[model samples]
Target chain A: MLATMLYGPGDIRCEEVSEAKILHPTDAIIKLSASCICGSDLWPYRGANEVTAPMAMGHEYCGIVVEVGSAVKTVKPGQFVVGSFCLSDNTCPHCRFGFQSSCEQREFMTGAQAPYARVPLADGSLVATAELPSDDLIPSLLAVSDVLGTGWYAADAAGVTEGSTAVVVGDGAVGLMGVLAAKQMGAARIIAMSRHKSRQDLALEFGATDIVSERGEAGIARVKELTNGVGAESVLECVGMEESMSQAINCARPGGKIGFVGVPHGVTFDGQQLFFQQKSLLGGPAPVRRYLPYLMDLVLDREINPGKVFDLELPLADVAEGYRAMDERRAIKTLLRF
Target chain B: MLATMLYGPGDIRCEEVSEAKILHPTDAIIKLSASCICGSDLWPYRGANEVTAPMAMGHEYCGIVVEVGSAVKTVKPGQFVVGSFCLSDNTCPHCRFGFQSSCEQREFMTGAQAPYARVPLADGSLVATAELPSDDLIPSLLAVSDVLGTGWYAADAAGVTEGSTAVVVGDGAVGLMGVLAAKQMGAARIIAMSRHKSRQDLALEFGATDIVSERGEAGIARVKELTNGVGAESVLECVGMEESMSQAINCARPGGKIGFVGVPHGVTFDGQQLFFQQKSLLGGPAPVRRYLPYLMDLVLDREINPGKVFDLELPLADVAEGYRAMDERRAIKTLLRF
Candidate 1:
C-alpha cells in the first residue's frame, strides 16, 4: 500500500508502506473509496505546528469495510461507511450529549490517505449505509465524514434559524460548506468574507447572499453595512487565527452566537473584552460522528452537492502535489484517488 | 439630601448632596423606598477597579416616581417602579432582541443610593407596578433592580432548563439569586460553591441541592462527584476573577454552558485552551431590563424572598459602616434606609 507521510516542513511523501490491519477487537479494516488533504494538514507542512516525527497524513475518509474484528458488531465486510476524523465510543456521556469529539475514549483518525485504513471502535465510530451507493456519490459521502459534517456543526453551533442573518468568517472549503448549511437551516441572509474570485463564486453558488472582500476593519464595516448596522445574529468562524476570531466576534450583534471550527494556533482572548462584546462562543473539533447519519442521508439522497468543493483531484502517488496545490491556494481542496 | 460617595479606596462617606433633578426629557426622578450596597461596589472600594473621582456608591434601587421629565410617558408621579442599573432605550434592535444592556443608547444608572435619584431612559428602563406594594416587599423589589435580575440573567444565559443540573460559582447576593433562578427554571440539582456556613444556609434555603466547600480543583472534583462524574449542564460564573472563571469552566461538562454576569477584572483566556475545553461561553453585564417586569412581579407576589440576601440593615447616615461591613465580609449585603 502507498500512504502519505510528512517528514518535516514542506516534505510530504507517498511511498510503499505496510497495509492497515486491525490491532484491536473493536477495529475494522476498510478499503478507502476516497480521501483528501485537510487545510489543517498545512500546519505542520508550513512549520506552524511541530513535525516531531514522520506523521501519518489524512483523517477525512469514506470507504467499504473489507474485514472486521470479532468484537465489531455494527459494521461488517462489504458494507459502505463513513466516519468522523475524531473516533469515539459513541455510548460515552459526552458522545450521548452530541460532543463525540470530546468522548472519554476518543482518538483521532489517521493514515486514511492510503488505500486501506484501520478504523477503531468500529461499531461506535462508523455509520454504515443501508445499501451501497452509486459511484457518483463517493466524493459527497467522503465529505460527510468530516468537511461537510464540520460545516454543518458550525452552522448548528451558531444557532442559525429561519429568517436570521449569518456571517461566515472564512472562504475555505469548510466556509463554503458553512454557507450551504446556513442556507439549509433557512437563514435569510448569508454573508461570506473572501478576497479571492474563485472562492467568492463558489460561495455565491453555495447560497451566500453577500460577499465582503475586505479583510480587517473594512470587512467588519461591510458586514455591518449589509446587515443595516446591526450585525448578523449568527457568525461561523471557520478560521482560527486571532484576526479572524476577532472579526467573527465583531461581526455579530450583542447576544448573537459565534461557532468557530478552525484549530487555533496562537490566539488569546481578554476576558474583559469578551465580556463587553457579549457574544455566545462555542468552538472545538466538530462532533462529526453526531451528524454522520443525517448528513450521509443528505449526500446519498443527492439533496446537496458538497463534492463541488473538491476543485482539484489527484492520484494517491501525487499526494505531495495535492498538498502543494492547496497550500499554495491553487485549489480549494484536493480529493485523492486510490 | 444625603448620598453615599467613594472618595477613594476605603474612603466611603455619607455627605449632603444637591437634590436629584431631571437632566433629560427621558428622565424620571424617583424617591427611593430603599437602596443597598452591591458586591460590585466593593470592586472600587477594594481598589480592584480604579477610583479616580468621588463615585456615587450604589446602583440598586426601587422607589416611587417623584417627578417625570416632560417627555417621560410610561412612568409618572406616585407610581412605584423598579429600574435596572443599566438604562436602555427598549426600542433599539439589541434591546428588541432581548439584550437591553447592549442597547444603542445604553447608560448606567448612578447616584441610586440617594433618597432621590434621576433615572435616564425612564420609559424603557423602569417597569412600574400597577399599585404600590406593601413595605414588606420593598427589599425584594429592590433586589430585582440588580442582584436578582443579574442572577436570573446568569441562569438564563447558561440555558437552565427542566431537569438540567446547574453549578453556581459565587456565593454573593447575586449568586444566591442565581440559585433561586435555577430553581425556578426547574434544574434537577443546584450546586452552590461556597465555603461560608451562613452563605451555605442561604443557598440551601434558596434551593441549592448541594454545597461544595472546596475551592479550585477539589471544588470541581466535588461537583463532578455529585453529578456522577458528569459535570453540570449549566454553570453560573458570578465571580469575575480568573480563578473563579476557571473553576466555573472546569465544573461544566463538554458542551455545557457558562453564563457569567460578574464584571470581569484582569481576566484572560488562552484561545487554544478554551477551544479544547469544548464548553460554551456567554458573559456580560446582565440585561436586567429584559427580566425586570417578570422578576418584579415574582417579588411583589412573595413567591420568592430575595430580600433575605440583605443580612444587614443600616441607616443611610451609616453608609460608611455598611461598606465596611460588606468589604470585611462581615455582612453578605446591606440594606440602607433614608
Candidate 2:
C-alpha cells in the first residue's frame, strides 16, 4: 500500500509501505476514502518538531471498514465510519468523562494519508452513520476526525452560547471552522481575525460578523472596539504562537474565557496579569472523538458545509505537493483523494 | 488615628496618621474592629515585591461603619460590616456575573490595619451581617474579607465535589484555608502539602486526609501514590511561583482543574504540555466580595474557624511587629487588634 511518510523537515514522500492489518483484537483495517493535512502537521513539516524516522503521516480520515478483528463488535466490516485522530477505548474513566484525547488506553490513528490504515479500539473509537455518506460529503466527514471536532471543542470550551460575542484569533482552516462552530453554538457576533482574502471570505461565509486584519495588539484593540471596549465574551485561539496567545488573552473581556485549541508553540503565563484579568484558560489536545458523533450528524444533515475548507484537492500520489501548497500558504487546506 | 505603614522592604512602622473620612460620595468610613496580615502582605515585606513609598499595610478587616457619604445608601453609620479587599461597585456586567474583583467600578480598600479606613463603593463593597456578632467571632469575620474568601474561590474554581480528591499546594494561611474550603465543598479526600508543623497540624484539623511534606516532583509523586497514580481530581495552588505552579499542574489528573489564587510571583505557561494534559487553569485575583456574604454566614454558624491561622497578635500601635513576625516565619498569620 502507498502511504505518506515524513523523513524530515521539508521532506515528505508518498512511497509503497507494508500493508496494515488488524494486529489487536480491538483493531480494524480501514480503506481510506479521504484524508487531509492538519495545521498541526505543519509543525513537523516546517522542522519545528523533531522527526526521527520516516513515520506514517496523517491522522484525519474517514473510510470503510474493510476488515474487523474478532473483538470489534460495534463497528463491522463494510460499514462507513469516521474515527478520531486519537483512538480511545472510550470505556476508561477519562474517555467516559469526554476526554478521549487523554484516554488511558489510546492510540494514534495515523497514516491515514494513504490507501489503508489500521484503527485501534475500533468498537469505541469509530462512529458510523445510518448509511454511507456520498463521496461528495467524504471531505466533511473526514473533517469530523480532527479539525471540525477540534473547532467544536474550542467553542465548547470557550462557553460560546446564544448572544455570546466570539472572537476567533486565527485564519487557518481550523480558525475558519471555529467561526462555523461558534455560529452553530448560537454566537451572536463572530469576529474572524484574518488578513488573507481567501480565509477571510471563508470566515465570512461561515458566519463571521466582523473581520480584523490587524495581528497582535492592534488586533486586540480592534476586537475591543467592536465589543464596546469590553472585549469579546468568548475567544477561540487557533494559532499556537506566543503572539496569538497574547492576542487571545488581551482580546477577551475581564472574566471572559479563552478556549485555545491551537497547539501552543512558545507561550508563557504571566501570573499577575492573568490573575488580575480574572480570565480562565481551558483547552488542550481536543477530545475529537467525543464530538465526532454529533458533528457527523451536522454533516449528514447538510446543516454546514465545512468541507469547503478544502479549497484545493489532489490524488493520493500527489500528497507531497498538497503539503507544499499548505506550507507555502498557497491553499487554505488540501484534501487528498485515495 | 494610628495606621501601619511600610517604609520599605523589612521596614514597617505603626504611627499616627490622619483619620480616614468619606473621600468620595460612594465612600464610607469604617472603624476597624479587627484586621489581619495576609500571606500576600509578606511579598513586599520579604522584598519579593518592592515597596517604594510608605505604603499603608493590610487589606483584610471587619469593621463598624463610622460614617457614610451621601451616595452610600445600603450601608449606614453604626452598621458592622465586612468589606472586600477589592472594593467594587458590583453593578457592572463583570460584577453582575459574579466577578467583583474585575468590576468596572472597583477601588481597592487600603489601610485596613489602621484604626479607621475609607471604604469605596459602600453599597456593593460592604456586606453587613444581621447584626454585629460577639467579640470572640471578630477574627473569623475579619478573615472573610480576604483569605477565607480566596480559599473558597480556589475550591470553587477547582470544582471540588463531594467525592473528589483535592491537593492543596502551599502551606500559607490561604492554602490551609483551602483545605477547609475543600472539606466544606464536600471533597472526599484533602491532601495538604506542607513541611511546617504548625501548618500541617492546622491542615489536619481542617480535614486533610493526608499530608505530603515533599515539594515539587517528589510532592507530586506522593500525590499520585495517594491517588493510585492518577493524581488529584482538583488542585488548589495558593503559592504563586514557578515551582508551586508546576507542582499544581503535575498533581492534577487529566481533565482535572487547577484553581490558583496566590499572587503569581513568576510563572510561565507551557502551552504544549498544558494542551496534552487537558487540564483547566481557572483563577485570578478572587472576587472576595462575592463570597463574603456566604463566608460570613459560615462563620456566623460556627461551621468554620479560619481565624486559627493567625498565631500572632498585637495592638494597632505594634503593627510593625506583626509584619516582622509573619516575615520571620514566626507566625502563620498576624492579627492587629484596634
Candidate 3:
C-alpha cells in the first residue's frame, strides 16, 4: 500500500507502506472512496507544529467498509460510511451531550490519506449509509467526514439564526464552508474576509453577501461598516492565529458569539481585555460524529455541493504534489483518488 | 456630607466632602437609603488594581431622589428608586440586546458611598418604584441595585435553567447572591465552593445543594464526585483571580458555560489549553441594568431576602470601620446608613 507521511518541514512523501489493519476489537477497515488534504495538514508541513518524527498524514476520509471487528454493531462490511476526524466511543457522557470530540475514549484519526484506513471505535464513530452512493457524490461525502461538519459546527456554536448577521474571519476551505453553513442556518448576511480573488469568488458562490479584502483593524472596520456600525451578531473564526482571533473578536457586537474552529498555535488572551469585550466564545475540535448522519444525508440527497471546494485533484502516488499545491496557496483543497 | 474614600492600599477614610452636584443634564441627586461595601472594593484596597488617586468607593445604592436635572425624564425628585452600578443609555443596541453594561454611553456610578450622590444618565439608569415601601425592605432593595443584579447576570450568562446543575466558584457577597439567583432559576443542584463555615451556611440557606470546602484541584474533584464524574452544566465564576477562574473552568463539563463577573486582575489564558478544555466562556461587568427591573420587583414583593447578605451595619461616620470589617473578612458585608 502507498501511504502519505511527513518526513519533516516541507517534506511530504508517498511510498510503499504496510497495509492498515485492525488492532482493536472495536476497529474496522475502510477502503476510502476518496481522501483530501486538510488545511490543518499545513501545520506540520509548514513547520508551525514541530515534526518530531515521520508523522502519518490525513484525518478526513469516507468510504466503503471492507472489514469490521466482531464488536462493531451499527456498521458492517460492504456498507458505505463516513466518520469524524475524531474517533470516539460515542456512548460516553460527553458523546451523549453532543460533544463527541471530547469523548472519554477519544482518539484522532491518522494515516487516512492511504487507500485503506483503520477506523477505531467503529460502531460509535462511523455512520453507515443505507445503500452505496453514486460515484459523483463521493467528494461531498468525504467532506462531511470533517471539513463540512466542522464548518457547520462553527455556525451552530456561533448561534447563527434567522435574520442575523455573520462574519467569517478566514477565507480557507473551512471558512467558505462556514459561509454555506451560516446561509443554510438562515443568516440574513454572510461576510467573508478574503484577500484572494479565487477564494472570494468561491465564497460568494457559497452565499457570502459581502467580501472584505482587508486584514486586522481595517477588516474589522469594514465588517462594522457593513453591519451598520454595530458589528455582526455571529462570528466564525476559521483561522486560529493571534491577529485573526483578535479580528474575529472585534468583528462581533457585545453579547455576540464567536465560534473558532482553527487550532491555535501561540495565541494567548488577556482576561481583562476579553471581559471588556463582552463577547461569548466557544471553541474546540468539532464533534463531527454528532452531525455525521444529517450531513451525509444532505450529500446523498444532493442538496449541497461541498465538493466544489476541491479545486485540485491528484492520484495517491502524487500525494506530495497535493500537499505542495495547498501549502503554496495554489489549491483551496485537494481530492486524491486511489 | 460624609463619604468613603480609598487613599491607598490599607488606607480607607471617612471624611467630610463637598456634596454631590449635577454635572450633566441627565443627572439626578439621590439621598441614599443605604450604601454597602462590595467584594470588588478589596481589589483597590488590597492594591490589586493601581489606585493613583483618592478613589470614591461604592457602587451599590437605593435611595429617594432628592433632585433631578431638567433633562431627566423617567425619574423625578421625591421618588424611591434604584439604579445599576453601570449607567447606560438603555436604548443603545447593546442595551436593547440585554447587555446594558456595554451600552454605547455606558458610565460607572461613582461617589455612591456618600449620603447624597449624583447619578448620570438618570432616565436610562434608574428604575423607579411606584411607591415607597416600609423601611424593613430597604436593604434588600439596595441589593437589587448591584449585588443581586450582578449575581443574576452571572447565572443568566452561564445559561442556568430548570433542572440544570450549577457550580459557583466564589463565596463573596456576589457569589452568595449567585446561589440565590441559581435557586430562583430552578437549578436542581447548586454547588458552592467555599471554605468559610459562615459563607457556606449562607450559601445553603440561599439554596446551594452542596458545598465543597476544597480550593483548587481538590475542589474540582469534589464537584466531579458529586456529579458522578461529570461536571456541572453551568459554572458561575464570581471570583476573577487566576486560581478561581481555573477552578471554575475545571469544574464544568466540556460543553458547560462559565460566566465570570469578578474583575480580572492578572488573568491570562493560553488559547490551546482553553480550546482543549472545551468550556464556553462569557465574562464581563454584569449587565446589571438588564436584570435590575426584575430583581427590584422581586425585592419589593418580598419573595427573596437578599439583604441577609449584609451581616454588619454602621452609621455613615463609621464608613471606615465598615471597609475594615469587610477587608478583614470579619463581616460578610457591611451596610452603612446615614
Candidate 4:
C-alpha cells in the first residue's frame, strides 16, 4: 500500500508501505476513500515543528472498512465510515460526556493519507453512515473526519447562537467551516478574516456576511468597526499564532466568548489581558467523533458543502503537489483520492 | 479624613488625606461604614505588583451616602449603600450585557478604607439596600461590596448548578466566598483547597463540603479521587498563582469550566496545555455590581453570612496592623472601622 511520509522539512514522499492489519480486538482496517493535507501539516513542512524522523503522515480520512477485529461491532467490512483523528473507546466516562478526543483509552490515527489505515477502538472512533455516500459527498464526508468537525467545535465552543455576531480569525479551510458552523448555529452575522480573494469568496459562500482583509491591529479595528466598536459576541480563532490569537481576543467584546481551534504555536496567554478584558476562552481538539454522526447527516442532506474547501484534488501518487498547493496558498485545502 | 496609604513594600499607614468630594456630576460621597483588607491588597504590600509612590489603598466598602453630586439620581444622602471596586455607567453595551466592571466609562474605586470615598458613576456602581441596617449587618453587607460578589462571579463563570461538584482553589476570603457562592448556587459538593486550620474551618463554615490540605499535584489527585477520577464539573480558581491555576485546570473534568477571580500575578497561560486539556476559562475583576442586588438580598435574608470571613477587626488608625496581620497570615481577613 502507498502512503504519505514526511522525511524532513520540505520533504514529502508517497512510497509503498506495508498494508495495515487489525492490531487489537477493537481495531479495524480501513481503505480510505479520501484524505487531505491539513493546515497543521504545514507546521512540520515549514520546519517550525520538528520532524525527528521519517514519520507516516496524515490524520484525516473517510473510508470503507476492509476488515475488523472480533471486538469491533459498530462498523464492519464494506461499510462506509468517517472517524475522528483521535481514536477513542466510546464507553469511557469522558467519551460519554461528549469529549471523545480525551477518552480514557485514546490512540491517535496517523498514515491516513494512504491506501489503507488501521484504526484502534473502532467502535468509538468510526461513525458508519446509514448508506453509502455518493462520490460527490465523499469529499464533504471526508472533511467530517477533521477540519469541518474541528470548525464546528470552534463554533460550539464560542457559544454561537441565534442572533449572534461571530468573528472567524483565519481564512483557512477550518475558518471557512467555522463560518458554516456559525451559520448553522444561527448567528445572524458571520465575519471571516481573510486577505485572499479566493478564500474570501468561499467564505462568503459558506455564510460569511463580512470579510476583513486587514491582518493585525487594522484587522481588529475592522471587526470593531463592523460590531459597533463593541467587537463580536463570539470569536472563532482558527489560526493559533500569537498575532492571530491576540487579534481574536481583541475582536471579541467584553463578556464575549472566544473558541480557539488552531494548534497553538508560541502562544502564551497574557493573564492581564484576559482578566482585564473579561473574555471567556474554550477550545481544544474537535472531538470529531462526537460530531461525526450529525455532520455526516448535514453532508448527506446537502445542508453544508464542507468539500468546497477542497479547491485542489489529486491522485494519491501526486500527494506532494497537493501539499504544495496548500503551502503556496493556491488551494484552501487539497483532497487526495485513494 | 484619614485614608490607608501604601507607601511601599511593608509600608502601610493610616494618615490624614483630602476629604472625599464629588468631582463629577455622577459622583457621590460615601462615608465608609465598613472596609476590609483584600488578598489583592497584599500584592503591592509584598511588592510583587509594582506600587510606585504613595497611593490610596482599598476598593471594597459598604457605606452611607454622605452627599451626592447634582446629577446623581439613584442614590441620595443618608442611604446605606455598597459599591463595586469598578464604577460603571449602566447604559453601556457591556453593562447591558451584565459586565458592569468592564463598562465603557469604568472607573476604579480607591481609598475605600477611609472615612469616605468618592464614587464615580454612582448610579451604576452603588446599590442601596432597602433601609439602614443594624451594626451586625454592616460587615455582611460590606462583603457584598467585593469578596462575596467576586465569589458569586466565580461560581457563575464556572457554570455551577444544582448537584454539580465544584473545586475551589485558594482558601482566602474570596475563595471561601467562592465556596459560599457554590453552596448558594446549589452545588451538591464543594471542595476547598486549604492547609491552614483557621482558613479550613472558615471554609467549612462557609459551605465547604470537603477540604484538601495538599497543594500542587497531590491536590489535583485528591480532587480526582473525590470525583471518582473524573474531576469536578466546575472549578473556581480563586488563587491566580501558576500552581493554583494549573491545579484548578487539572482538577476539572475534560470539558469542565473554571471561573478565576483572583488578581493574577506572574501567570502566563500555556496555550498547549489549555488546548489539549479542554477547559473553559472565564474570569477577571468580578462584575460585582451586576450581582450586588441579589447577593445583598441573600445576605439580608440570613441565607449566607459572607461577613464571617472578617476574622479581625480594628480601628482605621490600626490599618497598618490590618495589613500586617493578613501578610503574616495571622488573620484570614481584617475589617477596618473608620
Choose the strongest candidate by DockQ. Answer: 1
lDDT of 3 at B238: 95
lDDT of 2 by residue, A1-338 (tens): 88999999999999999999989888899998988899889999998899988879999988899999999889888899999998899988788778898889877778888889999899889998889888889989988888888888889888899989999999998998899999999999999999999889999999999999998778888888888778877999999899999999898887788999998887777777778877888888788888988899999999988999999999989988999999999998999987
Worst 10 residues of 4 chain A by lDDT: A268-277
Report the poorest 10 consecutive residues by lDDT, candidate 2 chain B. Answer: B268-277
Q: Judge candidate 1 at residue B78 and give its lDDT.
A: 97
lDDT of 2 by residue, B89-177 (tens): 88887787788998888777778888888888999999988887999899899988989899989998898999899999999899998
Q: How good is the docking of model 3, by CAPRI class?
A: high
Q: What do the candidate models score in CA lDDT, each in turn?
A: 0.93, 0.89, 0.92, 0.91
Model 3 segments more than 4 A misplaced? none
Our model 3 lands, by Cα RMSD against the true structure, at: 0.9
**Tens-digit lDDT string for candidate 4 (B189-290):** 999999999999988988889999999999999999998899998999998888888899999999899999987787888897799999999988888888
TM-score of 1: 0.99
Every candidate's DockQ is: 0.88, 0.70, 0.88, 0.84
Which scores greater on TM-score, model 1 or model 4?
A: 1
Residue lDDT tens for model 4, A1-338: 89999998889999988889878899899889988899989999989899898989899988899999998888889999999998899898899889998899988889898979998888989999877889989899999999999999999999999999999999999999999999999999999999999999999999999999998999999889998999988999999999999999999999999999998999998776789989999989988988988899999999888998999989999999988888898888998986
Global local distance difference test of model 3: 0.92
Candidate 4 C-alpha error for residue A136, in Å: 1.7
Cα error, candidate 4, residue B126 (Å): 1.0
